[model samples]
Target chain A: MRADTEQDILKTELWWTALVTAVVTAIMLAIIYAGLVHHINPPSNIETVDPKTLHLTGEFTEGNLGTRVDGSQITSRIVATQFAFQPQCIVMPANRTVTLRFATPDVIHGILVTGTNVNTMIIPGYVSQVHTVFTKTGDLLMPCHEFCGLGHSQMWATVRVVPEDEFKPGPDGRVTCDAR
Target chain B: MALAPHPNYSAQVPPRVDDAVDDVALERVMREVPSGALALSLLTVGLLLLAWFLMYAFVFLPRGMVG
Candidate 1:
C-alpha cells in the first residue's frame, strides 16, 4: 500500500509537468500559426526554374530585373549567379507589399536580409519567392547565407526600403536604387 | 505546560536539520493541491510566454519586411 501511494504521487507530479509542457508548446504553435496567417512571418513558395539560362532570357533578363509596380501590385525579380547579385540593390517603398523573387544560375545560394523576415534558399534550378512589407525605411543587407565560392564572403546585396514619397518609378513602372 | 530546566547546551544532543526525507514525506508534498513544484513551473512558463509575446509584437513586427 505504501509503495502504491508513492507511485501515485510520482505519477501525479509527472502529470502536472506534462500538462504544463503541453500548454507551453501549444501557445508557441498558436503564435506561429497566427504569424503565418497574417503574413507577418517569412514564407517560402518554392518553384522550379532553369539555372543554365536564367539570365539569358525570361523575367530575370538584363532589362527585366528590378521592382515593377502596377495598380496594387509590386514585384521584384533578381538573379543570383557567381559572386554577385545581378542588380545589387532594388528600391522599394516602405509599408507596401513587395514580392521578391530569386533564381540562381550556378550553385545553391541562400538569401537572408538583416533585420527582416526574408530568408529563402536559392537552388540552382529553383525559384525562391517571398512577399513582405517594409515598415521602416532603411538600407537592409542581403547576404548570401550559403557558401557559393571563393567570393562568398563578399557576396551581398542591399534592399533599399525607401519612403513612400521617395520610391518613384519611371513611366515604364521600373524602380531601381541606381536611379537615386 | 511547564518549561523544562536548562541543561548543558553543548552536552545535549544536536538536532538533525537535514534528516532523510522518506517516500511518505515526498508523497505528502506531492499530494497537496497547487504544490510548490507545480507553482514554480507555472510561473516560469508564464514569464517565458510573456517575454515571447513582447518580442514578437514590439521588436519583430516593427522591424518590418524585405520589401
Candidate 2:
C-alpha cells in the first residue's frame, strides 16, 4: 500500500515483462535464421491421389518406385503399404538435393529418417514430399512412426546414401540398392 | 472498592502481533521478499534459455536441413 512498495512492484513487473519479450524475440530470430541460412522448413506438399488405384498406375506403380535421376534432378518415389515400403532400400548420392515422395494405400503413415530433419506424414489420399540433402554418407533408417497395425514396428526402410562417385545409375537412369 | 460491572471483557482481547510491525520494518520486508523472488525467477528462466540454446545448437543444427 505504501508508495515505495508499489513503485518496487511496478519496477519488478516491468522487468519481468521485458525479459519475456526478449525471450520471445530471440526465439523468433532463431527460427528466421534457420529458415534463411540453413533452409530448414516443414514438408507441406499437398498432392492428391486415389488410394485404391495408387499401386495400379501413375508414379506410385511397383516398377516405378525407386531412385530416378532425370538430368539434374534426383527423385525417389515409394509406396507405403500395410507393413513395408515398396522398395525396402533406396540409393541416393550424398550432398545432392533429392526429393522423396511418399503415398500410403492402406492407412496414415509417417516417416522420419534417423539423424536427419526429414520427417513427414503420408496420408492415404495424398502424397507427402520432402526435399533434403543428406550430408552423412551411410545407411539411415526410415521408420514408419505412425502405428498402423500389428506389424507397425517392422514397417521400416533404409536410405542408402553413397558418395557422389559411387552413385551409379542404370541405363534407365534408376538407382537401386541391389546394384550397389 | 466495589467490583466494576462486566470487567470490560471485550477490551481484554490481544492485538494481532504479525500486523504490528513499524513502517520501516514493513518496507524492508516488502523490498527484500520480492527481490529474492525476482532473483530466483531470473535464475530459473536463465537456465531454461541455456538448455534451449544448447539443444538448438548441438542437436537440431547438426541434423542438417529438410523442407
Candidate 3:
C-alpha cells in the first residue's frame, strides 16, 4: 500500500479505457469520412436503351465505340457483347472528370475496374453510366464480373489513364490507348 | 495444557524475504517500459500511417469515380 492524494484516488481504470476507445473511434470515423468525400467509388446512373436496335443509330454506333471529349466532360462509350468489350483499350486523361457509358447488346454483364470502386451491371436494353475522375496515370484493368457465357473469363479490357500533359485528342475528339 | 502435536504433521519454516532486494526488483519491472519497445511501437504507427497515405493518394485517388 502507498499514500495517495485525495484527488488522484478518484480516478479509475475506466477513465483511461474510455479515453483510448474514443481516440480509436475518432480515427475510424476520419478514415470513413475521407473515403466518402474523395470520389473514389462513384455510383452508376442507369438509363433505358433499346437493345434490339442499339447498334442501328444514336451514340452507341460503331464509330463512337470509344471515348469522346465534349465541352467539359469526357464520355466513354462501350458495347459489351458476347465475349468482349468493344474498344478494349480506352484512353483518358488523369485528374479529369469522365462519364463512362456502357451498354450491352446481348445478355446481362457486370464491369468492375480492378483497384477501383467502379462497378456496374451492364444489362441489355439499358445503359449503365458512371461519372468519375481519374487521379492516377496507369493502365486500369476492367473485367466482366457477371457470368455471361463460357468465354466470360476472357472478357476484360484496359483503361489507360494518361497524364494530362501527355493526353492527345484528335480533331474528331477520339482517344484510344494505342495513340499514346 | 491439553493440546498435543499430531504425529503426521511437521513444523515448517517461512521462506526468507529481503524487503530491499524484493522491492528493487519489483520497481524495476513495474515502474517503466523499455525504451526500445516504445520506439518500435511508435515506428510501426508511423509506417502504418505512411502506407495508408500512399495508398489513398496514389492507388485510390487515381482509379477514378464510381458513381
Each model's DockQ score: 0.18, 0.58, 0.30
- Interface Cα RMSD per model, in Å? 4.2, 1.1, 5.3
For model 2, how does the per-residue alpha-carbon lDDT over A89-172 read when each residue is reduced to its tens digit? Answer: 999899999999999889999999999999999999999999999989999999999998999999999999999999989999
Q: RMSD to native for every prediction?
A: 10.6, 5.6, 8.6
User: Compared to the true structure, candidate 1 yields what TM-score?
Assistant: 0.73
lDDT by residue for model 3 (A1-180), tens: 123332233343445456557657866775575568765444546579999888898889999889888777789999998899998989988878788899999999999877666888999988898877777779999999999999999999999989988887889888877777
Candidate 1 error regions (>4 Å): A1-5, B1-51, B64-67
Candidate 3 structure quality by residue, lDDT tens digits, B1-67: 9779776455464666765667556555543444454466558866876787788667765654557
Model 3 alpha-carbon drift over 4 Å, by segment: A1-36, A40-42, B1-64
Per-residue alpha-carbon lDDT of candidate 2 for residues B14-33, written as tens digits (9 for 90 to 100): 86577667988878889899
Binned by DockQ into CAPRI classes (incorrect, acceptable, medium, high), candidate 1 is incorrect
By DockQ: ranked, best first: 2, 3, 1
Q: Docking category for candidate 2? A: medium
Candidate 3 structure, TM-score to reference: 0.61
Chain B alone, TM-score of each model? 0.51, 0.68, 0.52
lDDT (10s digit) by residue, model 1, range A1-180: 367766776887789878878877877875675576554654557678777778787887889898988877888998887799979998889888888999988899999888877888888888888988877788999999999999999999999999998888899999988788
Residue pairs of candidate 2 with colliding backbone atoms:
none
lDDT of each: 0.81, 0.92, 0.78
